[model samples]
Target: MAKKPDWSKEEQAVQAVQLAFDLSNDIQRAFRVSAALQDMSTADMVRKVLQLPYRRARARPRLTVTLKDEDFELLAQKYRLDPQDRAAIRHRVAEELQGFARNYLTDSGH
Candidate 1:
């Protein structure tokens, strides 16, 4: 008699949901390559990509800032961020500044 393999609780739970799809060879190959590059299973990659919330593009106000080397270095160290990743740095700074403004306004009863 063949022995049955054991599965972890998480694996068992995931196994309960089964999704099957038929794709063209080219599409399948593309998904396989993408999944391999990301070091994830095809199913997991598909699930993650499908689960992301869709957002429509809209124009938003932008802020521009010029920083000296010393100031940039200080901000990078304080945020524990990479200076080369300008987009991430900008996003973090914007979020922090917005939060600070909100807190200050609330505290001042404005």
Candidate 2:
């Protein structure tokens, strides 16, 4: 019988290291705008611009953002949803975004 090889060390070796960049506000906003226009996450856009290989796209596409109390209040007013009901507020926001994309994003989905 042969002894099994350890896999924990190999797992750590293959793990990706996260990196951070301290860019100016204007540059950050520009990157974000470019990514949004291309329907990509900012990280993916940056990697593509640098010609770096990146992981494949997820099975299900999604957009994520952190909404604070003030954000919720504003969204509630604009969406006429109950601010206390976060789920409803989030669903409405998603619906609104879908509407915006359906209306504005070109047929190419860009």
Candidate 3:
């Protein structure tokens, strides 16, 4: 048997609903540039323009990138690791990013 809904009626009433849509490439780029120039996230800028309530910020900030299967394979090859060992590849990628920051910081005397 399928499991029942986890949310209570009152809880569901207050749940946030996502609004997502696609835009043409030119329009999308313009929107992104506008947001960046104003130092606002695209989502936050959109909310302000639409007169919607702001989102609650996460307690911890995190960076994210979406990688395709081919991208993963490339990373594995670059790092000389098994493609199946995704965790190790991710660790290596993180190390590379940290090294990049460290190098820039040292070079710029920051």
The top-ranked prediction according to TM-score is: 2
User: Candidate 2 residues 10-103, lDDT tens each?
Assistant: 6877886888999999999999898777777788878988999754453356878998899999999988878898888988988889988887
Q: How many backbone clashes does candidate 3 have?
A: 0
lDDT by residue (18-59, candidate 3, tens digit) is: 788788998778777776666666777688678887544533
TM-score of model number 3:
0.51
Against the true structure, candidate 1 reaches a TM-score of: 0.38
Candidate 3 differs from the real structure by a C-alpha RMSD in angstroms, to one decimal, of 7.0
Ranking by lDDT: 2, 3, 1
Q: Taking the tens digit of each residue's C-alpha lDDT, what string does model 1 give over 2-26? A: 8998889998998786778898999
Per-prediction TM-score to the true structure, in the order listed? 0.38, 0.55, 0.51
Which regions in candidate 2 have their CA more than 4 angstroms from the true location? 1-16, 22-53, 106-110
Q: Scored by Cα lDDT, where does model 3 land?
A: 0.81
Off by over 4 Å in 3: 1-18, 34-40, 56-63, 68-70, 95-110
Model 1 residue runs over 4 Å out of place are 1-64
